[model samples]
Target chain A: MLIETDVLVIGAGPAGSSTAKHAALNGSDVIVIDKKSEIGAPKRCAEGVSKEGLKKLKIEPSNRWVIKELSGVRMIAPDGTSVWLNEEKVKLPEAGYILERKVFDKHMAMDAARAGAKIMVKTLAKGIRREDDHLVTTLETMGEEFEVKAKIVVGADGPESRMGRFLGLKTTLKPKNMESCAQFEMVNVKMEDPDSIEFYFGSVAPGGYAWIFPKGDDIANVGLGILTTETDKSAYDHLLEFVKNNPSTQNAQPVELNVGGDPVGGMLKELVTDNFMLVGDAASQVNPLTGGGIITAMEAGVYAGEVAAAAIKDGDYSAKKLSKYQERCEENIGVKFKRDLKVKDYLQSLSDEELNSIADAFHDIELDTINTAELIKQLIKVSPKALLKLGKLF
Target chain B: MIIMKVNEWCMYCGECAGVCSRSLIEVRENSLKFDKKKCKECTICIQVCPVQALAKEE
Candidate 1:
């Protein structure tokens, strides 16, 4: 069966769906395909995102998908010296939230569908055949095989994206640039303040941090991410210890356990190639410092969709044309990502003592004070010993 | 069932000590020290410490 469309988007996650939605909205014939049978099932995310990121995607926060509105943030030093650095706070209307990713993803897909994009779940792209000016894709749909052609293809697949690799772009990520994350949902867990998310740094989660994002007063998602190169222990092992000893959650019942890997590298070498563009994890759009990718993925999707439509209208689908999407992302966030990558590089080299001293220097950063670069500079001012390492990181 | 392991690079910022309700961490000689026995092994010290200095033994 040869299905044809102006734009074909792979993967149905935030990036893919948003890409399809934006493209369809722009009067292009868009078709979205996902290997998963369900559009938003088996959610793999920490599900915490800043308000500014959502605004970039024009996504209004909805109550159905938002778990909680965080009041502030807390940072802990290695020796237990906790300081609230962003103490002078201004109330941000859309501060931040713990989201139900499955619902959030589905909602985005629904938006795409409403905008006239045809979605086929359980349809996996097996291979791509470039025939003349068009690209043909072999797809496996519900145990059946089919073929489809498109003028332009957008890869919104997750980190395991073959489209990016098959095209000869650099997808090889070092262990230091990736995070292995594990999470547990606990019920009846006593939380200190449900309105604020909690993070633990230091040895508990080497190369990464542990987070307690509250769903409610007695329910929270407790998770940890470990840099694979920094520690031999798995993320699950660290999370298990956090549950066993913490009184606030010692007696809690485990509702769910999730584990996954996140690519911390900021961007891909070539997110755009001939007749193709990559978004989300496929393009390495995740934040290096926080491992958050939803907003960036959505932002990329919007750009890709818009670009796909324009490309189809212009009848130019070469790598040079698709590169505009990358240019747009670079313009919007490229500087920030480069700076954040430097921060990640610098952070991975710190010792526990150095980490503690840096913590002492900056204290804890509050919600109102989330200047990542400034905090690192302040730490560098105090911990001159870490300066040598800082020079290499920057 | 929680195993707490302190790593070699700990900076002793005391953020872990402050957040540890169980009082498992202490600062001595400008270094952050963990009392393994007193450490409920909650691993909160590891997460809040910011420097990624603490570890949980599997």
Candidate 2:
């Protein structure tokens, strides 16, 4: 099977689907392929997304995929001190929904198909080579081999992007920048606040945090991400220890397991070259502090698609032309990521006592009445050491 | 010669493949493939494995 398309997207996840949809909508023929037989099985995400994130993508919350709506967020320190922020009062759209990613991902792909993009599942991109003005990608599905020739190749293939490497991009993640994560979908848990998501900080997670995103009254996705350089224990071990010690999840039984690596920092300086562009995890678009990439990936996809379509219309697929995608991404989310990375580094440097002191300062405050600057002022009064380290964020 | 080894605890999650400096690892559906000939034994993959399923072998 020799197929030729204006854009070839390798991965059927959020990024690739959105890219294909926008490209096809703009009158470019797009083809998307994934190695998985099913679109979204064996989930790697904790399935948390903000309402603002959805609004930016012009997508409405659907009951078919949305499992729970959160009302607030809680941050717990190592010494058991916690600070809760009301979602409505803070005007932070961070509180959102816990989704059934298996269904959500499939729906996203369906949207691309409706927009006239072709999708091929269980297809693996074996290799890619340049040929004249176009690129040829060898694909293998089942027991047969085929080729796809496209003027533009979009690599949306997760953190472990073979496509990016094949295109001669430096996509390797450093140990300090990558977070090894493990998650379990547990049931029969006793959640005190089912309407809010919880984060546990300090040595329990080591350079990262543990999360509990409630899926229902008695179920949640219990997970943690840890920087490998911080500790000798694997992410799984940290998660198991966290689950055993945490009160609400001490008795919960895990029904599903998820493990993966996330690029928390170190965004690729270059995202495109010639006729190729990288989106999503391949491009390291995840938030440095929260390690969330669904929204960012989709945003990058939209930009990539628009740029690819314009490039094709102009009949110029050079790196210089494709760089418009990079510019749009940097303007939209890259600036925020840079600041978040600094904050993440500062947080990682704090000791358990320092974290406890920070939590203590916020515990008695009226979070809604105070702005971030005021809160930081209050924090500085309580812990002067934090003032120097956190000054960079402002 | 140095090579990367995958133990039984491997989850096929592809964490190692993504961080491999040399891009020498591949995660199939149920197995992991290592291009031993091109491996530099940087050990980045072993460090990033969530389950500690990978190791450096000589």
Candidate 3:
């Protein structure tokens, strides 16, 4: 079957859904397609989002999607000393939420549908073609193939997106920069303090860290992120090893397991091209420090929707017009992400001993008062020799 | 029998204990104590031990 629309959105995750929601609300005829039959199936996330990020998108905490409200965090050094911080005092007022991601993502898509966006699920986009001034696509739906024509195409297709690749943008990620992760959803576990999230940083996880995000009194999501370049251990291996060794969680019943990666690098130098735009994982908008992408992806979607609407109104689909989306993202969200990457890089450079010592030293400090940069600065203040090893990355 | 012990440097934060599957370890007297009999020898404890204290019995 052949269909035409004002805008075509690929991959109905946060970015695609939000883009469709905004465009449909503005009276643009939009269609979103995803390969999955269901909107939020086969969950592959840590399911944690900062409070400030959700509020920015105007998504309030709903019981259906929110499993718990997180107010503080605990950092465990390699030496075993711990530092705790109240998230609010740190200026992350909405600090974060341990969400039921499947529900949350599905609901976001529903919001778009309610606003008049037509979604095509279980549809795989085969390839793209440029005809005259329009973009054409051949999509496979439920064993059958179909063609779609649109004036504008938004690629929210995620990490393995082909749309942007076909348009000639560098989509390759270096092993040094990518984080491999694995997690398990556990139940019947007793935590020392269930309300606070926990982080374990050391060489064990390599460039990344391990986390325990409490979902409720007895349920939690435990995961780890490891730098791909540092080790050959798979994320599942890391997660399994941690589970076998930890005393607090050793007694818990294993319920489910999750594995994935976080692309902690910067945004693509060019997320837009002639008549095309990228968002979400496709655009590499994930937060470099935390490997969180829901907030950034949604924010990117909002900008893309607004830009695509304006472009349609003016009948202009050139890269020059879409460049506005890139500008808005950089000014609003990109700046913070860039800074976060710097911090992430710094953290990645530390030795297990150094991480433990830093944790031990900071045990007495108030967490809410220190930004990541300040913490690193303090580490430098206390140890001049350590700073020398960093070599001016600061 | 593998005897897993959390390092004295550990704060009993239970990050490793919480992710364990065999229910072999527990926090007692503000330190990691274990029951090696129930251990499935998964070694999640060794990998996530923030203090690098947990070690297999020789």
Candidate 4:
């Protein structure tokens, strides 16, 4: 069998679905395919994102998907020193909520469907190659095979992006720049605070951090991520130990467990080739410092969709014509991503002593009197080059 | 029971980590690792792996 469209998007994750929706809204015929039998199941995030990211994407907060709306964030250092910033006092990247990704992801895909993009679940792209002017993609669904011919192909697949490789673009990451994450969904977990998300940093999750995102009064998602270095154990071991030792969740009942790898490499140097563009994780659009890509993926998706639509209308699908997507993302979040990469590197270089010292530097600070700008200014006095790069991370 | 094992072909992209019902497997920066004791052998990880790097220990 064969299917044809102006734009064929692979993978129905946040990136792919948003691209398809936006492209369809721009008058381009779009079809999105996912190998998954369901659109949004097996959620894989700490389930928090910047509220500003949603507002910029014009996504309104809906009660349908929000698990908990958080106004502040807390980070615990090695010596048990803690620092926090509230939404009322923080900057672009810091203020947001603990989300329910399962519903959140489905809602975005549903929005795409409502926008006129055809969504094909359980359909997987097997192979793709350039055939004349159109890119030919082979897909498998159940026990059948079919071909899709499209003027533009979007690879929102993921970190193991096959389409990026097909385009000869570098999309793989080194271990140092990737995170292995694991989480447990707990009910009746006895969360200390219903409105504040907690993060613990130290040997408990070396090179990465552990997060407790509250779903309600007694339910929360307890998760930890670790750099896959020469750790004595895997992320699984760390998370298990973390749960056992943590006071707040020692008796928590495990409702579900999830694990995944995330690219901490920021945006790819090349996200486009002739007739093809990469969005979201396929393009390495995740933040190197935060291991967050929910918004970055959607942001890239919107750009890729809009750019693909314009290219189709102009009848030019060359790399030069598709550079607009790259430019748009770079202008929006690329600079911040690059700076954050430096901060990630700097954090990795810090010893536990340095981390503790930094935490102590913020000791006794009144929360109401603090703001991100003032914090950065204070940080600059401690280490100019280091904190200057980290200043924008908030 | 969930049984898990990493085959020799695993490219360590860590996609399988996304599917495990339990946090039994982990993606090392350069390799993949899993605690067989934790494997439910649900086979979700094996099914999602693009390189077929995981398998039922079984």
| TM-score to native of every candidate shown | 0.81, 0.97, 0.83, 0.86
lDDT of 1 at A119: 92
lDDT of 2 by residue, A214-303 (tens): 998799999999999999999999999999999989999999999998889846888998999999988999999899888999999999
Candidates' lDDT values, in order?
A: 0.74, 0.89, 0.76, 0.78
DockQ of each: 0.02, 0.80, 0.02, 0.10
Candidate 4: segments with Cα more than 4 A from true spot = A92-95, A367-377, A380-394, B1-58
In order of lDDT, best first, we have 2, 4, 3, 1
lDDT of candidate model 4 versus the reference: 0.78
> Which regions of candidate 3 deviate over 4 angstroms?
A93-95, A368-377, A385-394, B1-58
Tens-digit lDDT track of model 4 for A109-196: 8999999999888776767899888999998777699999999999988765666665677765555556777789997687556688
Chain B TM-score in each of the candidates: 0.69, 0.90, 0.76, 0.74
What does candidate 1's lDDT look like per residue over A18-95, in tens digits? 999999998899999887766766666678887767876678989989878777665555576555422146433223
Docking class of 4: incorrect
TM-score-superior candidate, 1 or 3: 3
User: Residue A171 in candidate 3 has what lDDT?
Assistant: 52
On a 0 to 1 TM-score scale, where does candidate 1 land against the true structure?
0.81
Best by lDDT: 2
Docking level for model 3: incorrect
DockQ of 3: 0.02
- Best-fitting candidate, scored by DockQ: 2
